[model samples]
Target chain A: MKDNIKKSYLLNIVGILSIYLILKLLIGGNVLNRYHISIVIFICINIILATSLNLATGFLGQLALGHAGFMAVGAYVSAITAVALKSSGLPDTLMLVISLLVAGIFSGIVGIAIGIPALRLRGDYLGIITLGFGEVIRVIINNMKSITGGAQGFTGIPRIANFDNVFWITIIVVGILYALTHSRQGRAIISIREDEIASEAVGIQTTKYKVLGFAIAAFFAGIGGGLYAHHLAFLDPKTFGFMKSVEILVIVVLGGMGSLTGSIIAAIILTILPEALREFANYRMLIYSFILVVMMIFRPQGIFGTKEFSLSSFLHKLRYNQIISPRKEIKGDE
Target chain B: MAILQTTELAIQFGGLRAVDNFNISINEHELVGLIGPNGAGKTTIFNMLTGVYRPTEGDIKLDGVSIVGKKPYEIVKQGAARTFQNIRLFKNLSVIDNIKIAYHNEMKYSTLEGIFRTKRYWKEEKKAHQESLDFLKIFDMQDYANTLAKNLPYGKQRKLEIARGLATNPKILMLDEPAAGMNPQETYELMDTIHFIRDKFNITILLIEHDMNLVMGICERIVVVDHGKIIAKGLPEEIKNNPDVIKVYLGE
Candidate 1:
C-alpha cells in the first residue's frame, strides 16, 4: 500500500514537471509562433471554463445556462482591480494574482447568491432562472457606464498574461478540478446529480453540495476570465454575453457531461475548429448546430461519456503485459 | 422506549389523503415492517418520516424532538437514513463513491481544503474511502469498488443502496420496498442481509416489503395499512391472521 502511494506521488511529480517543460516548449517554440500561443492560451481558458461548468451541469446534473455571467463578473472585477492597482508599483504578476483572486471571490459570492434561491428549483426551471441571472449580469455590466466603460467595455488594462503564465495556471486549475471531481465531496455532488432523493436519504446535504459546485465553478470561471481580461488588455460585455455561455455549454455537452478528460479534449477541439474553418466562418455556427443535432440523435452522452482515465486502471493492465512477455522485466512488475 | 415517534401525521395531495393521522413508535435496534395494499399510504408514510414531504398536520419526533418540517438532510443528520423503492445510485460514480456520498454529513474539511488538496483533505478522503469500502464489503461488493453504480446488476444495486444508507451511520435506517423487483433467490438473500445489518449494526430498521415470507421471517413487528390508515399493528402471526389485512389484500 505504501509503495503504491509513493509510486503514485512520484508519478504525479514527474507528470507536473513534464507538463511544465511542454508548456515552456510550446511558448518558446519557433514552429507555431505568437498567434498559435495566444490560441493555445485561449483554448486553455475555455477548457477551464467548460470543465468548471461541467461540474455543475454534467456531474452535478444541474442545467446552468448563466456560466458566461459568472465569467463576466470575474472579467470585470479583475479588470477594475488591475487598472486601479497598477499605479501602486505592485509587480505585474502580483497584480494579476490579486485580480484573479478578486474575480474568483466576487463571482463565487454572486454564484452563491443566485444558487441559494435556485437550489430548490429543479430541471428546466433551474435552466431558465440561471439563464435569466446571466442576462441580468450582462445588463448590469453594460449599464455600469463609468466603471465598466459601459458598451465600450473596459480597456487599458495591463498585459500580464503570457503563454507561460496562463499555461501553468491552467494546469493548476485543471489539477484542482480533477482532484475535486474524484474526491468525497465530488461524489456527494454527483450522487445528487444521479438522484436527489437517494442522495438525501444517504445524508448528503444536497443543497450545500449543489451550492459548493456552483461556487467552485464560478471561482475557476473568474480565474479564467481574469486571464482572458489580462490577455486581451481589454474587455467587453458583448464578448461575455449569452452566446458565450452557449458556447461553453456546447463544449461541455460535446465533451461528455461527467468526463473531465472529455471536457478538456472537447475544449481544445472546439476552440481550434472555428479557426481552422475561417473561410466559412459564418457557416461555422450552422455546421456546429447540425453536429449537435446529429450527436444528440446518436450519442447524447457525448464522446467520452462519464468514464475517467485513472492511473490505477492503467496500472491494472500491466498483468496483460506480463502475459505477453514472461521473461522480460516488466515496468509494472516492480 | 421509542427513539422515533409520529403523532397523527397526515399528508394530502388535493383531496386525496395519502397518509392520514399515521402514528407509530420505533424503539432502538428494533426491526419493524410496514405492509399494505397497493395504495395503503406505505410509501407516503415513509416519505413523511424521511422529510421528503411535510405532514399537512402532525408531529414526527426523533428522540422526543419534533422534526415534522425538517428537510430530508436534516432528518438524516438527526440519525435517520433511508433507501428508495427505486434504486437511485449515482450512475456515473464508482461503487466506493456511491457510499462516500453518505459520509458527506461527517466530512470535516472545508471547500478550501478540497480545492487545494491540503493535508486535511487527504486525511478526510482516506477515512471516507476506508469507511465506504467497509460498507461495500458487507455486500461482497469490494471487488467492484471502482465500477460505476449503474453497471451493477439489480441485486447488487439494491445492496449498494443499503450500503450507502449504512455509510450515513444512522441510528435509524429505512428501506422502501427493498424487494420490489428481486427474484425469489435475491429476495431470500436480501432477507439474510437485512438480518445481518440489523444485528451487526445494532440500529433500528423500518422496512416496507410486499413479500410476506421475508417480512414474517425477519420483522419483529408488522404494521398493516389500507388506503391511508393503519388497520393492524402486531407480530407476524397476529398480522397474518388479522381480518382487516386479509380484506385489503383480497380487495374485499
Candidate 2:
C-alpha cells in the first residue's frame, strides 16, 4: 500500500513538472507570445482563487460572496510591501515572496475579523454578509486617498509576478490546498458541509472548521491578489468588485463543488475561454453564456460532480482502456 | 452509580411545554429505553440530555459534570455521543470517512500539520484510518467502507449511524429511535448490535424507540412519557403493564 502511494506521488510530481517545463520551454522558445504568457499567468491566478474558494464553498459547504474584497486587500497590501521592499537591496525573488506572504497574512487576519461575526450566519445570510463586506472593502480602498490612491488606483508596483514565478506559486498554493483537503481537518470541514448538526453531534466543531476554511480561502485569495498586482504592476480597486467575485465563483461552480481537480480544470477553461472566443467578436460573451446555460441545464453538478481527477485513476483508465468511475477510497499513504 | 442522570429536566417552547419534569437515571453499562406515542416528548428529553435543547429548568450530569450550557460537540467530547431520530449520517462522505469524522476530536493534530503533511499528521491519520476499518469490522461493514452513506441500505444506514456514534468513545450513547424505519428482522439485528456494543464498550445507553418489541426485549428498564411528562418508569415488565402507558397508547 505504501509503495502504491509512493508510485502515485512520483507520477503526480512528474506530471506537474512536465507541464511546468513545457510552459517554460514555450516561453523560452517564444513559441507562445507575450499575450499568451499573460493569459497563462491569469489562469494561474484564477486557479489559486478557485481552489481557495472551493475550500470554503465546496468542502465546507459555505456560500461566501466577498472573495474579491479579500483579493483587493491582498493586492494593495502586497503592492505597498513590494514598493517598500524594492529599495531594501534584496533579491527580486525574496521581495516577491515576502510581499506575497504579508499580503496573505493581512487578508487572512481580515478574514478572521469578518468571519467571527459573518460565519455565525449560514446559507444566504452568510452570502449576503460576505457580499456586503466585500463591497465595503472595495469602497474603503476607493476612498482612502492617503494610502490606497482612492479611485485613481495604485500604480507602479514591482512586476515580479511573471509567468516563471507565478506558475510555481500557483502550484505551491494548489499543493497546500490539496494536502489540506485530504487530511483530518479536511474531513472535518467536509463533514460540516454534509450536515452541520450531524457533524456537531459527532464531536466535530462546525464553527471552528467553518471559520478555518473561510480564513484559508481568504488567505489564498489574498495571495492570488498579490500575484495579480505584481503581474499587472498596478492596483485597480474597481477590478476586484462584486462581478469579480461572481467570476471566481463561476469557475468554482463550473469545475464542480467539493472537487479540487474540477476547480483547477474549470479555472483553466474559464480563464482561456474568452480569449479563445475572441474570433467571434461581439458574440463571445453570448457564446459563453449559452454554454453556461446549456451546462446548467444538462450537468448541474458541474463537470466532475464532487469527484476528482487523479494520476492513478488516469493510469488505471489507460491500462484498462475503459472509463472507471472515480473512487473515494484511496489506500494508505493518502 | 448513575453514569448519566437528569433532575427535573424541562424545556418550554414559547407557551407550550415540550418536555417537563423529565427525570431519568441510567447506571454504568445500563441499557435504558425512552418511549411514548408521537409528540409525547421522548425526543425532546434526548435533545435536552444531549445539549441540543437547553432545559428551562434542571441539571444534567454526564459522568458527574453539569453539561447544561455546553454545546452538542462539547457534550460529545465530555463523553456523551448521540444519533438523531432521522438518519443523519454524512451522506456524501464515505462510510469510513463518516467514522473518521467522529474521530476528529480524538485525533490531536493542528490544521497546519495536516497542510504540511508533517510526521504527526501521517501518524495520527494512519492510526485513525486503520482503527476506523477495525471499527467498521465490528458492524461487518468493512466491505462498505468506501460506499457513500446515502447509498447504504436503510438498515445498514441505521447500523452505520450507531457505529459512527460509538467511534466518539462516549461514556454514554443516546440513540433517538434506532429502528425508526426498519422491519422486524432488521430491528432484531439492531437490537443484537446495540446489545453487543454496550457490553463491548462498557458504556451506558439511553434509547428512544416507538418499536415496543425491540425496546421491551433489549432494555432492562423503560421510561414512558406523554404530553411532556413521564407517565411511568420501571422495569420493562412493569412498563408493559402500566395503566398510564396503556391509556397513552390506546387512548382513554
Identify the leading candidate in terms of lDDT: 2
List ranges where model 1 is wrong by over 4 Å. A26-29, A279-299, A310-334
lDDT of 1 by residue, B139-235 (tens): 7889988777789999999998898888888888999999999999999999999999998999999999999888999999999888889899999
| lDDT by residue (tens digit), candidate 1, A187-267 | 777888888878877777888989999888988898988899999999989998788999999999998998877798889
Looking at model 2, residue A205 earns an lDDT score of 82
Whose TM-score is greatest here? 2
DockQ per candidate, 2 decimals? 0.59, 0.88
* Poorest lDDT segment (10 consecutive residues) of candidate 1 chain A: A325-334
Q: Which ten residues in a row have the lowest lDDT in candidate 1 chain B?
A: B110-119
